[model samples]
Target: MGEERECCHHRTKERSEKEYKDMINRLSRIEGQVRGIKGMVEKNAYCPDILIQVAAVTAALNSFNRVLLANHIKTCVTEDIREGREETVDELLATLQKLMK
Candidate 1:
């Protein structure tokens, strides 16, 4: 999808086919990891084992975030700035603040 400005202030960013597929694949793996964690809980697996799995999932999510952030900076942020959309920078800063928190 191309950039969409919704009436309710929600925005959408279109991704290239490769980017979209990569994101979807990463999400599917994360979903599987979560389901595995739930299974571990149901099976009464060792606490340490569960914690390790959780950490793996957290790292995977962080990696995904890093990739997505890089893509956004390279594309959306760069394009917006080139087009004289100063507000995009402020929006990015606000997003970064929230991510950091």
Candidate 2:
């Protein structure tokens, strides 16, 4: 039997229309880039060319992460701090450490 239950570690955010669209658009572009890489592999493209495309995809992903992290700091982190939720700062630090690694 399949059952749904609330997860203690799971949370959700309500994003603005623009934010939602922006995220989806970015992900779509990344998906397209990955598909292009797959095509390159299938078509026996040059190794260097495929590697370069993979690098581009990595850069795109990092750019997306930067945007998301900035938004999180501006919204979630700021609001949590304002509400005297000091644990949010610790959580932010842990996230930063993970990202750095």
Candidate 3:
């Protein structure tokens, strides 16, 4: 259940155990944060307090994106470029644009 971009032309990279664990850990933390936010809403917590927690979750998600993007660029992008697959660069750019939005 890794987050590889499902494409017919692309290949999947097998992440190192450490990398996999780190991503899983980050996702777990984010999941917990979401649950906390749900609890806060259920208990009628203050708006500002709930917003703060929501911001934290967004920050955590951004961090996860950064880590995943860095790894993708380092491994998948590099390999594709080496293999003369110019389309991968376009795909990467498109992905980055979406992320920026």
Candidate 4:
């Protein structure tokens, strides 16, 4: 990521470490879920069960995206607004519109 796009919130060493750990933990869980799905496919699991697992992974990904987007808006976008960056607000809105679709 570009330096200019860095999150406005200043991260202490501890917070950085915690965030990294949390992300890694979440990713690992998602990885395990994906592996489970792969195994289910190989074993010819029931279609409904496979669909349920797929839905779960999609929900998990959407939840993760929501958290990241919330953080970005709270820190970066809010800072931009306070610093007289009206254009950034429009840019954010446009980006969100795309995401919603």
The CA lDDT at 56 in model 2 is 99
| Model 1 Cα lDDT, one tens digit per residue, 1-101 | 77642111136776778888999999999999999999999999999999999999999999999998888888778877777787888998998999899
Number of colliding residue pairs in model 2: 0
Across residues 1-101, which tens digit of lDDT does each residue of candidate 4 receive? 54434455343122256656876787788889999999999999999999999998888888877877786777677877888877768877897998898
**What TM-score does each of the candidates earn?**
0.88, 0.88, 0.89, 0.76
**What would the per-residue lDDT of candidate 3 be over residues 29-56, giving only the tens digit for each residue?**
9999999999999999999999999999
Clashing pairs in 4: none
Listed per candidate, the RMSD to the true structure in angstroms reads 3.8, 6.1, 4.6, 5.1
Residue pairs with backbone overlap in model 2: none
Global lDDT of each candidate: 0.85, 0.85, 0.87, 0.76
Worst 10-residue lDDT window, candidate 3: 4-13
lDDT of 4 at 87: 78
lDDT, residue 62, model 3:
98
Residue range 15-92, candidate 2, lDDT tens digits: 778988999999999999999999999999999999999999999999999999898888777877777787888988
| Candidate 2 segments whose C-alpha is farther than 4 A from its true place | 1-10
Q: What does candidate 3 score in Cα RMSD to the true structure?
A: 4.6
Q: List the residue pairs that clash in candidate 3.
A: none
Residue clash pairs of candidate 1? none
Q: Which stretches of candidate 1 lie over 4 Å from their true place?
A: 1-10
